[model samples]
Target: MEPCERARLHAYFSKIASQFAPAEPAASFLVTHLLAERPAFVRAVAAMSRLRAVLPKPKSVNAAAQREVEQAIPCDTLSRELFTDPDTALNYLESRAPGESIVLLDVGGYFTPTISELHSRFSGQILGVIEDTENGHRRYADVDKLPCPVVSVARSPLKDPEDFLVGQSVVFSTEAVMRDRGDILHGRPALVIGFGKLGSSIARLLHAKGVQVTVYDIDPVRRTQALSQGFVVARDREATLAGAGLVLCATGSLSLRGEDFPHLRNGAYVATVTSSEDELELDGLPDVYTRTAASEHVTRYQTTGHYFYLANGGNAVNFLHGASVGPFIFLVQAEILAAIRMLTRAGLAPGMHEVSANDRAAIAATWLSYFNR
Candidate 1:
């Protein structure tokens, strides 16, 4: 976007920011910006971090699950699908269309759309990727083999896709923005609910930064492995929630005990994978209800959003933080997969990141339609 366009986008956001404060959810904010075609989103992190929400805590890592991951994860060959079919993958997403022009990216501790299915869905539309792992690249080597137009950006060019994607691209802002809210995370103790792709990524980030991290999950094996990795593991929610600063829920489970929140330090931050928003309640917390992303720090606050509904909202916490580092690999690869048959049909090239507002708007719309249906 040009300087003028960027400025106009900011103005638009300033106007709508107040109207949206009540939503207390990321999607409401993201989807709203998508609709306005205002790419320059006034990030929720910028809004919530101002208060310096004093949300912090610490705990032990879960045992059984950690041990299992330590034993099973480290040496596995991430190259092969192990046992997944590419064609079925595309079909699966086609069945779920969501009617949006999507850029498929992975979320930790959550199920992801398959490669072939994602490729088939966004044929000729995808361009770049934003990944946190080396394996993410190996899986789609064919795209990498393509020339120029298909180049991939390895580092978290938290800078801009303009470094790569130029003109009107349909992009997927995956894990990038998810873990961004530094104000919320500044001095907090953390807990990771699931250690799958999403959970593990965030846990590693927190630990690397020297924050006390505790892991919790249903898989007994994963629990043990995470512990061995040196992370403190908790036995259950009851054990993990005491005085916690931030809780990242990336699991498939829907409801967790309320006592977990009551014990949370007042003004604590709680974020989850975009997919898990409905699983837990953020309204009835012990004191002040703070709704924010793991990446961007905070999004909306239930305590202040009016008439606590226990529904704080959702954002891709993984994307929030992952964006902090980037070439925006995950969905960039997905978009490339989507554009494969169509764009690559003409010739081969490494897909780029920076996407067009039109493409993302379409994807968001389609995603909305699918979810509504």
Candidate 2:
């Protein structure tokens, strides 16, 4: 993935700021996002609506980001704590006026309070919620119905390119990890669980990197798709792990566990790009394996018979180890702006909703025009 040109970023987001107008205007919004660290992002969002408060996630914030938030967003409008800290996030939301029409802007609702607590505290003030990641979409899975519309970029068609770019980032970072550990990536067998959009890109990247890659997906159609792409498709999880020197999970599902550790090859390394630790269960293995901190983001585990590793403690390794995908993030920001605008006016029947085809086209056009310039 290429570094985004700063000039293009400013011009593109400035155009976004000029064109963005929510049909049913919100009184205010409490945005919980990793992008809050970017001054351009703060400025663009401020142009869209009355951004009441911002809860920046820990992983996305650094010294520079903290300075940017302080300098760009109003002190009264920014939460001091990491939004992932649930108690602090709940407290901040609780202090707000119940009657204030607020939209929950987030990547995965990490900063937002629980759905039940949100309704209890804010009542009908929650105009809607917009989420941008697969894990965030899964958070609402158990709800029989939602109080307001949910505009999810993760569930929408918008994630197609984003996940592909992420796959490229993954291979870049994974190669670094492999090199650090003295693992010969080329000619080594690898297992990729889940043949979804993210997994497919990963499989393609791995193949390009000269790894013998096998895919496992429960969805029969996805499995067939992988097979059609000329990659080996595993019968199941066990079949996938067998003799695999590297394993990566892109499935949002909680599929891997410590019990399955025995199935892995002696020197296999495991990593994940999903938002949850569920993709690679760390419960029992965390205690049993002798750990080695390879870096701030990479950790290695050694057992008597095998060596295993967990990237970013089983969190999304892309953000943890590699360069930030600024261009792709800008596209999602555009999608988010459009989603918030649509949700304010549209009466979506709860659950998860897609960005309208018109909105998608407009976003694409905006990005293409900017890129072409």
Candidate 3:
């Protein structure tokens, strides 16, 4: 975006910043994010309470953004290290957080595993956690016990922005792939795994682009929903993989595995819309198919007469191939701010929860007032 446009967006955020203050002051907060490049966003969240440390994604960090964060909060408060690994992130948190009066502001559920450790070590004083991804929310479901409240926007009605952006990313990536290999999407069959918000959006996007789409979801309700939406629903994985020209996994679970590779058709392109490397099972790719045809973002594997393509090397293909979510991202940031505010409320029950409908609607209405007007 142009500098003038960036400044205008930041000004809008600043106008709405006061609407999201925490009810009770937090001792500290640990934020795990890839969008720390947005100085205005970082400063807005830091203004909510005392920011203990930031666990920024290595891919998202820039010298200017880091400087912005340091200038907003004390330099000593921000950690220079990126939180990529679970163990390292846990260790860093354990050392810095005093345990009591701390909240986790997370995007990928990187802190899910450490929640138990933090609760045990800190005597259950961890305030709460705010998560923004479906993959991260899944981790919360697996846990039988949670010492503090956890709110997720991934499963909430407020995820309209993310849903819209998911479609946008797919369109951009599909166009790029087609440009590289003409008419790849023309009259081609594409398989989409998972029928949740992101998956459903992707299926529609591809269908609108004239690619035949078949959606697969483990949930009977989701499968029914996909079918009702006028999209073909796949009954089995092997069958779907056999006929698909493009296979995209948006399922939060590890949908693609090592054994599933053999099911893929020759000249097929497989990519992940879901978060993390495990979603696409990148470890399963054999070394023989090591030809890098389209930079590190796209991997090519050929065996005998068959060729297969992997987008973003099993990472979230959208981020690798398309631009950021733009203004829609601020909606999520606002949701995170609201979640933090909710955490300060008295008697919030422990366990996974959605950011209340009231909070979501308020943010949406506020956003529309600024841009929709």
Candidate 4:
């Protein structure tokens, strides 16, 4: 939100707006983390079409600030709480503009089911969707048939840099939260439960901090990649969890459940790096365990002789401290804008598609030129 950052973002978005024709009029729905930079991205999307409703992810931090920003834009900020339930979201969307053409811009496919339901009622009225996260992409991937064109920037090469920075932010925020409780990560045992882009980055960064990082991934290929990177790969997940002083779950799925809680080392700190609560089954905490608040961002769950800490109530710890990824995030945001532009064109096929390589290259070139200058 600095003056320089604002000016740079304005210039970048202006450049993108010039590259594509104005979007055909359609109501827009956006689901995203309400971070500081979100207002700029929202503004960029608003420029392309009519923004109907903005749904902030419940797990994302800084809702108050982002809500204030949304006041200036001509859109309704939907209830973050109600947005989670697909049926409720569908009802809200239906009530907003009945029988009108609508487009979706989502972060984690929170509206996947809502869109599916909408398609059943008003098929072609739903123009298309632009999804921005791998987590969201997987949600759409699970569907047997999509009702409209869905463009994903999740796995695009343009997102590579943003993924790297996300990992860095996770660690940075984790350290800050740990420090609040008079703890440090150096020379401690750590277990990272996923070896995907975010997991691998977290593992490497933790290892660089002198933490003995052990990695585990359900995928053999990812495990091999972790091993090749010179970090210990966990073959026995329970054993690794029992030994680590720190545990970070990077998998977007349910990486940890109630049954897995007892395996954690006593007094060990656990955290997640994904926006969804699905990453950890916190509600599944067994009757034996007693829960207590250790601090604003840390929770203590103890059972008899065993206990472990949960950071940020099992949500992404990075968001507890605002989840800043610096200016590099603009690359991915620009790609999302480009994806929205793609959705505006006629005759696009249904189902998920990668952000076009030409669009990716153009965005990357613009990013390089802006930063280099």
Candidate 3's error at 276, in angstroms? Answer: 4.1
**The candidate that achieves the highest TM-score relative to the unseen native structure:** 4
TM-score leaderboard ranking: 4, 3, 2, 1
RMSD (CA, Å), candidate 1 to true, equals 18.8
Kindly report which residue stretches of model 1 are placed more than 4 angstroms away from their true locations once superposed. 1-187, 252-260, 275-279, 282-312, 317-373
The positional error of residue 324 in candidate 4, measured at the CA in angstroms, is 1.0
**How high a TM-score does candidate 1 get?**
0.37
Local distance difference test, candidate 2: 0.70
Candidate 1 accuracy as lDDT: 0.39
| lDDT (CA) per prediction | 0.39, 0.70, 0.71, 0.81
- Collision count for each candidate, in order: 97, 0, 0, 0
Report the number of the highest-lDDT candidate.
Answer: 4
Which portions of model 2 miss their true places by more than 4 Å? 1-7, 23-37, 74-90, 96-98, 109-113, 276-278, 294-297
* TM-scores for all predictions: 0.37, 0.86, 0.87, 0.93
For candidate 2, the TM-score is 0.86
For candidate 4, write residues 1-373 as lDDT tens digits: 7799789888888888777534476777777787867788788777877777677776673766576656865345544345566667667777765777777888876667666667666523777888888878888888778878898988988778888888998999888889999999986699999888899899988988888999989999999999999989998989998999999998887888878888888889999998436688877779988889998889999989988888988889888777887777888888877777777774788888877788888888988888866
Instruction: Name the candidate, 1 or 3, with the larger TM-score value.
Output: 3
